[model samples]
Target: MSRDGTGVPHSGGAAYLGMPAFPRAAETATRDDRLRANLRHATHTIRAKRARAVAELDDWARLRQAGAAIKDRTLRHLDHHLVRLEEAVTRAGGTVHWAADAAEANRIVTDLVRATGEREVVKVKSMATQEIGLNEALAEAGIRAYETDLAELIVQLGDDLPSHILVPAIHRNRGEIRDIFRDRMASWGRPAPEGLTDRPAELAEAARRHLREKFLRAKVGLSGANFMVAETGTLVVVESEGNGRMCLTLPETLISVVGIEKTVPTWRDLEVFLQLLPRSSTAERMNPYTSMWTGTADGDGPRVFHLVLLDNGRTDTLADEVGRQALRCIRCSACLNVCPVYERAGGHAYGSPYPGPIGAILTPQLRGLASPLEESLPYASSLCGACFEVCPVAIDIPEVLVHLRERVVEGGEVTIRGTRTTIKPAKRHTAERAAMRAARWTFDHPGALRRGQWILSRSRRLRPRRLPGPGRAWTDTRELPAVPAESFRDWWARTRGGTA
Candidate 1:
């Protein structure tokens, strides 16, 4: 298989094209004991801390509601906020660029870096950039974009895909990280110091030393914001480490590629998220570094600032009434921590940069259910509702998953890249549809239903332990519930004399 510049198999522009469907990928992921161990440890630890952090707030529920409301209000009038933001940014000596899709966003960023005459740029951790494969695009253009965040740096050095939203290297343990640094650090730039250990501090020190040189020497920096305040043209990036601060401030030129959904109407609206995001995400009262900047400042920070307001299917996503709530995601990864499906199946199974429950809903809507991968994502969950409960913005992910499943089963009109097109129901579900139709027929006729139930009750002892043929797969890891010897109506008739 051919690989992209990033060394992962080419996923065909933003969408995970070559990857297997969710069920196939997840089946494979579940067998990896080591991967499961890593995910179990990391997710358990993070969620426990989050529980403590959330307990510190008496008004967390109210805060969550406020955050959700703020996001909804902003998304409802995104155009107005975007125009206001563009004007505010321009007034602050910043240039704004708009990108309609992933390809266009990559092209604009590549051109901007080329125009600066810089071959190397340092990057803060940004999901928007990852979604567009910005590093791979830059590599194609003969430019090197170094990841400055520790986890992101590990992923880059290891040539691995990110498995989690906040901790990209969540699937890798300390020992694995030590191996990556010891083996790959020199090729990138700085070599790991002699005999580097896997101790947390030593690993962090190695990454810091390695990234420090890039910070000082790089002429340009790239980032994505946690929040973009339209009222003041302010962009905020909250991090446990100060890498984002360095990337935001140290470079001569800074560029931010942010999704339009990240916008907030006012600074007061921004305040609601600041309070909710920390407790929900890193489980901290406040991030160690909360950097907010309003464009450029003379003789301070980056002399030149550029904000790329990227659409990239967000406008189409906003068109959806039920799924649009996913736009409220702050990329906190709280849902991933609480999700049982994510814990077992892992992030790679979803076959997109966004993963877990949010990915199940968001990826299909953003990219459309055109491929088996996208179509299968909506079925990636147990509909446990854990993700919805933990979400700071209350996105109700389970509702959207069921909604997307309906879309997959009974295809209809959908918006794709600003065009509405009709799609046919998936052929793969023919057997399922047939079974449902049979069930409907049996239920509609009272005599047939009664006879069927009586026959099932009489033959309960002779029922097969596992289903035959295609259903064997479903019964492989699950037990088929035993049927009762008596139906409820029969019991009622026998015990209570129903006619009386």
Candidate 2:
């Protein structure tokens, strides 16, 4: 309060910690009119455009099927393709590093940066870097990470968490962005111009000017690839802005951190995804800029190139028979744009780098259902199947969500950190388990069930509108159907005068 009058907001790139369960988070977000308006407008606009774009292609379904099939095949033989990828990259004179977890990935990147003798890095918008919290790690080692993407720059300045995957700053409108830039831009390196209005052109110009110096001076750059071709070792990055191209080409040292699942078996397999992703995510026939590079080139771009393949918790996710289908996600985020739950509840509630319907199922499996937030994520959705319909790779998100929910309620042996551990049912779910068991036993005894039903029918008037215990809150929003005065079985028997 004494230092800067404008309060310091939390960093958007910071890891999510101590987050409440999805219901609580979603409740808070629903009360926010601004958040609701922003989400409603953005999601509807993108989803509509996506529909139009997809309808333009006669073979879009075929392309989607091909994309799904390629990813599935690559996943089954991931070890072989990953090795082939490594060999191809090595042949192209690039070094490759494998990171089994987030900490290892961070350490590898930090070491590589320190080795470069540069304390600053210009970054293209890479979800992999965000997933590993690389920027924060770099700061710990006394290196500054500069975001080159305009939206990312706003997010970095605002000290906010990304509310969307593709457009990280979708939560904020232009006025909010202008305020962030005016207040925080100078602290970084450049300041917004005097009288900087919130006009799009003015904002764009200001951002361009602010980032020009960083681009020209940056010696190191880092990114995430949309797809990696195993056959040729090419990393493909598709972006609407030209910032990615600058980051890829201008830096003396280039580092790309990619998820193992991002690999496509061949360039032909790569082609299918290229067609699906742009239309699904951006609603464009093709993104304005698409960059593909095969390792380091001779005096052409980055003299030194390094590829870090990150596993993190992916192997654990792959181990889940039902949940592993999430690996097919191309991250188009069409699901997010179409999801009614996502439109209302927003992304941050998911408590992972990935959010929305994908996050609901994927995060729980990737991180395991140990934490309250992770466990609750499985039940965050209504399983309406919009996400399933919109997915480019055809991941059955609802099926996975239900599967994970079953695992949560009926906990058994779960592999945590590659070690098998038996997990007991959560204490909160024990009542539900007991109720279900009681119902099962009653169903086994027809006479007892009939008697119980008759008693309930006789005392129907005395029953409370709201149920007690765990059902209170559930009944708060929805009413239980009124019980009939007489059991249907009794009515049938009286009318027929015989056991039909």
Candidate 3:
């Protein structure tokens, strides 16, 4: 999931290397009945469980506040926390590398692994790695990276990209997974045990057996931590299966590449997030595996450890006041699960490694609203606000979504040199902009608006129930509200002399 030196396409706005906007992508996805069904079932199940889990915690609000505060404080003092984190890792016999962006991060990790003289590395599902596209980068460097997580394994074997952050294979069903395993399993290390069934246990056992050998033989294991305790200089990974534990502890050299935003000020702050994260994400009171490592622990685990703190647009993201809250996200995917849009369109439609509501805002901020895909992402949401409510770190996803939309719409109006220019709007959103401009003009001139309303009322019978031209696509699936015979302004004018 390494980034291709060129910033990964921003979801929905700037199409990656010239792709269609979110509406077009979603229209295509909606046509895929299998994809829609997979998304519907997966999102609903996760959303429901998340709702129930959230309901059980009376202290949830406090916890959310605590999580937000910790993150805010850490980010506010990120430079210091990071330096502290580095010192701790070094003192504990670990190495620290700073990556300015994805390209550097990938190059650093690739070189680090190459230095180890290992052609293959086993990975714990890590978003940072995916964000930087470590797997793809490693591949280009002639190294093979194996995904040890079940869902990641499924995606890797199927030659597919992750749709959901937590459940990378959320777009895939059991049957699809079975087929992927049956078809592609042997090509990568150990084959699936014979007679593997799609039943959860059988499939899991086969994966376990397949990955166990790699875990033992691989000299390097790469991961992303859910939380990096800045004060204690420890890294923490919370996982549902024991696979993360295996990856974290197995290899002779462990490389953890994490976003700078993942740091927390103290261990106690970590305690608050630990409580909030599992329930918000996996809906578990406690995860099956809680692996924490403070550098190397003598002969117990990896003798050599390296922690890569990756920026990759984070500093740019931090520069935006309104959008910076997105940095608080814990990669919970609660927002993704509860997203109505995600349920229908699925993850790939978002285009970046991160998907759904969080991705809609975060990706564009991290990558900037430069690309067509980045520009399109801000409008991806229905603004349902479900994502904001479910976020463990209390990121205001909808607020950030709109903030980014503003950035996209206003990008051309302001120059990097602090001058102004008008960039042509995309062909897709031109009509939308025109309509909005017309509405603004009408609202500003009440007298003309009244006359316009009277005319519309007289011709109400001729009004089309469906939108015309570009809008027809929007109204095709959604019912356009029937226009009333008289505008609300007209009704008010007649009843109250327009001023009452």
Candidate 4:
């Protein structure tokens, strides 16, 4: 690989650029019967497993409470804890770099890889890395970044975007995966067996065989951490597959780019999350593999370790008092599993790396509501609050969703890329906004409210079940409420005879 910092590699549309609004993206996904079946099976299976796993815990609520509190305290004293983490990492003989955003983080990692003189790096599944488009950026720099996780490997092989946070390829069934491997695996590194079947064992064997050489040959590894314990300067990654273990240990030079929000203040705080995360995410009493490392240890794992603390949009997200709670997310993706919207519309519709209920609120706030996609994201949810109930850290996703919806409709001042900018309400929503304002004005005046009700009642027969213009699209699927023949106030007046 050759590198001279002329320009950063374009991450391509791999990072959710130029995508249409949520409804449009969703419309395409919902049309695919196969995709719907895949999501339905995966989500239902996981949802049942998670509920059973969580039910086994007597102190689940307490554990959840502690997790939320710990994260809140950590975020409140985030600066202090981060400094402590850096100090601890340094004390343990590791180098730490701080990046304020994706571009800088990419540059730092690219430079670090260049310094190591390696053209290829193996990766554990890392949403943080994916969000920053690190792999594409590295590709631009002529470095090949391999995704070692099973689902991630499928996504990488198919040249597809991750459809789920926990299971990136949740949208893909086994048959599709076999086809992906049979056709695409050879091009990347290894080819599937002569007759690749979609059987679980066969698929696993194929992936294992294909990735073994890469694991042995790779000199550099890149990852994102699930939790960073400040007290011990230790980082943890929990996974079902042992691939993460290999990615963490086999490589000579390891670079971890992690969102700063993954930090916890102490070992006790870590304990609370350890209980909550596994059950919430994998629905296992404990994840099969929990890998922990402190900086670089001689003769055990990598000889060198670099931790890139990425703040991309975190500081800006943390600025909003109401929106800041999103930083509490542990990336367990419990919320995604239980989401009705995600099950139907799929993950790609929400756009960006984070999807489902989390992305609806988190992406817009993190990226800001400047674009149509971002603005449309807040409305993606039904506000059912299933996401909130399942969140291990007790984040109020629906509350944040509503808060962001207000941000979008009202067009207020918001911070983006560390600058305060006033955003205008979406032009597409102008009619809706006007209608809301007019309704509010009528409700505030008794005479007008009564007059409008009378007009509505008199014109009731002429009313259409479907609306006119843009509203017709919404009404096409949902039946507008049946208009009442008379207003409740009129009934009260007529029945009670205006006196008794």
Residue pairs in steric clash, candidate 2?
Answer: 12-160
Write down the lDDT that model 2 would get: 0.82
Candidate 4: worst-modelled 10 consecutive residues by lDDT: 1-10
Clash pairs detected, candidate 1: none
User: Where does candidate 3 stray beyond 4 Å?
Assistant: 1-19, 412-500
Best by TM-score: 1
Residues 1-500 of candidate 4: C-alpha lDDT, one tens digit per residue = 21111111112335777777898888877777678778878887898799899889877766777788888899999999999999999999889999998999999999999999999999999999999999888999999999999999988887778889999989889999999999999998879999889998999999999999999998999999999999989999999889999999999999999999999888777778889999999999999999999999988999999999999889889888889999999888888887878887888888788999998888988888868899899889875556776788889887687678767776877888888788887777876676546544765677986776677666865768778998986544333223335544565467532321
For residues 17-56, write the lDDT of model 2, one tens digit per residue. Answer: 7777888888877766677677777776787788889889
The sequence of per-residue lDDT tens digits that candidate 1 reaches over residues 119-184 is 999999999999988988998999999998999898788777888999988988999999999999
Cα lDDT listed for each candidate: 0.84, 0.82, 0.77, 0.84
Q: Which is the winner by TM-score between candidate 2 and candidate 3?
A: 2
Window of ten residues with lowest summed lDDT in model 3: 4-13
RMSD for each model, in Å, please? 9.1, 10.2, 9.3, 9.8
TM-score of each: 0.85, 0.85, 0.82, 0.85
The lDDT leader among the candidates is 1
Ranking under lDDT, best-scoring first?
1, 4, 2, 3
